[model samples]
Target: MSGAATLLLDAGNTRLKWALQQGAVRLHQGVADYADLSAWQAGLAALPAPAKAVGCNVAGPARAAALAALLAPLPIVWLQAAAEQGGLRNHYREPARLGADRWAALLGARRHHTGDTVVVMAGTAMTVDALSREGDFLGGIIVPGFRLMRAALAQGTADLGLPEGDAVDFPRSTGEAIVNGALLALTGAILQMQQRLSQRTGRTATVLLSGGDADVLAPQLQAALAVPLIAVDNLVLDGLAQLGAGDMPEQDA
Candidate 1:
């Protein structure tokens, strides 16, 4: 676990982020699009041979296959959501039905923080999950992210075209309106989850925010929540890193 780097891949809906990490230090990392593998391929050429590999493929098996072809010979442990793993218990009605990416994020969150937490992965789809102090996956809700919301509006409505704008105090233009509305909605959902988790745990919940849109959502959340917020670049990979260590979860095909 310490000598050779562990290759970690997190296949999201929109992107594939890969990293080579040895113990606590990340040796090399890069991201690439599923449709475009040039960077990923180039990265493979530049990266040293890793000792181990772990991944979660929420983008489906095709992407996993593509990655597997690239990292030929080195076997990867593609972890699925299980009843329990890495000390966190899954309380999903059907444990395997839970998204692999979300489960990984929770495992990563457990590594970073030990408290009542609202785990938010704001990506193609935003997932707001509740993790209790005792490491229980209490359930979560999913909603369209800012870009998806704006795109849906642009597609569904004739007036509101998907225009670039900023989140402001009061939006004057259609673009600004969409941007501000998305931010408000994102923060609102997070705050509500924080409140719910706090109410259930009887302790203030720390928001573990991750994914593509975390930076955009964090400021608004902090200003509104005033509770602890730990922003992670890629919690799924962190989860993969944990798996690479020794506490491997039951594999799912």
Candidate 2:
């Protein structure tokens, strides 16, 4: 089994992602929507049988049970955050309460960058976590994502129906205003977190942007960043891969 591939999954609120990793190298990667278990099943069938399958799930217990059933005899272990893992310290008041996705993302970030870091994952919810120069996960903030924010506007307001709009500084139309506003709010939150990290550490933090919306937010994020900004993919999977084979301990082991 030493040389066998390990299946890595990142189960978030909106999607299920997988990576087939053998040792330090990733052999394949893919994603599927939650509504389509058949798609995930087909995708899994096409891959090499992994020696071990591990994942981090935050989509709730019922989903985890369903996914576990889907994997069947293979038996998948869902990972959760610890006070510390892969050398990244979890400083959350309740360390175990930290989302596994965020924990895995931080672990992935540790491999991606050294120095102080501001980790951003933009998906169903956008999370911006701060890491100190010494590898302390100094917690983060979560905000409604671009689509969620826009949806909230549509749901909350009578006049602003959901319409396609581009992110622009000056919005001549209402749709443009909503779209631009969401992007600005998201990008602004990232910048603010980076600045806060820099202020506290006395050294500027590198920004590692990940998740589904990395491409959507990267251009604007890069435009406003003063420090290094790396747009990484599959951070959760990277963390899971780094994790190798493990269980979500009742407490940090």
Candidate 3:
């Protein structure tokens, strides 16, 4: 597979992550949303060579089908763990029940950090999955993401509101109260998970944060969690690209 050209896409709930690469070395990387694909195409058309694409979609079949249609002329590979490739053994009760986004994140986690590592993705949904040194998928936790938490509080409770600014500290106003609480809970959950992982594994695991809200959440989480938190903004796409290249060991289908 060395000389074969490749393109990787992580069509997540909020955005599209695309990358063109030769093995592990990326040539070009771009991001877009559903409305931004036309621009993505224009950018792709400007590239120099023929390429096959590998993608992981978490927005269900409709968006996946539309994405396939958009990349019709080129070879687009939808990601799935096969008996032959796409590393990281899935230990979910039902392997197929795992979310593609989580799978992609785990793959990236395993690729980026060796030894015991905890992959914490703070996106529309917060997910923390632990992987052992030898690549075992040890299970995970999921919680409402920050925005969802804010929305839920606003809709479900009286006197709760959404904040106008990005600050996630103590607030004097209703909106700020809601936002600050959400941030506290979000960061607290991540810190607790990191502590739990450390206690259980007896190995200090690296805490990695990704997804759209990572930058906003990282500082708070870092302040609280104390362990060094590495932010790899394009984790999903990087994992997709790495898996597509057959860079890691093969796994069960």
Cα lDDT of model 2 overall? 0.86
Taking the tens digit of each residue's C-alpha lDDT, what string does model 2 give over 140-238? 999999889999999998889998888787998888888889999999999999999999999988999998889989999878987768989899898
Clash pairs (backbone) in predicted model 1: none
TM per candidate comes to 0.95, 0.94, 0.88
In what order do the candidates fall by TM-score, top score first?
1, 2, 3
Score candidate 3 by TM-score against the native: 0.88
Provide the overall lDDT of each model, using Cα atoms, as 2-decimal numbers: 0.88, 0.86, 0.75
Best by TM-score: 1
Ten residues in sequence with the least summed lDDT for candidate 1: 244-253
Stretch of 10 with least lDDT, candidate 2: 244-253
For 149-240, candidate 3 gives per-residue lDDT tens digits of: 98887799776566565564558777767777778888777777777777887988788889888987888877776568888878888778
Which residue pairs does candidate 3 place in steric collision? Answer: 82-253, 83-253
Best by lDDT: 1
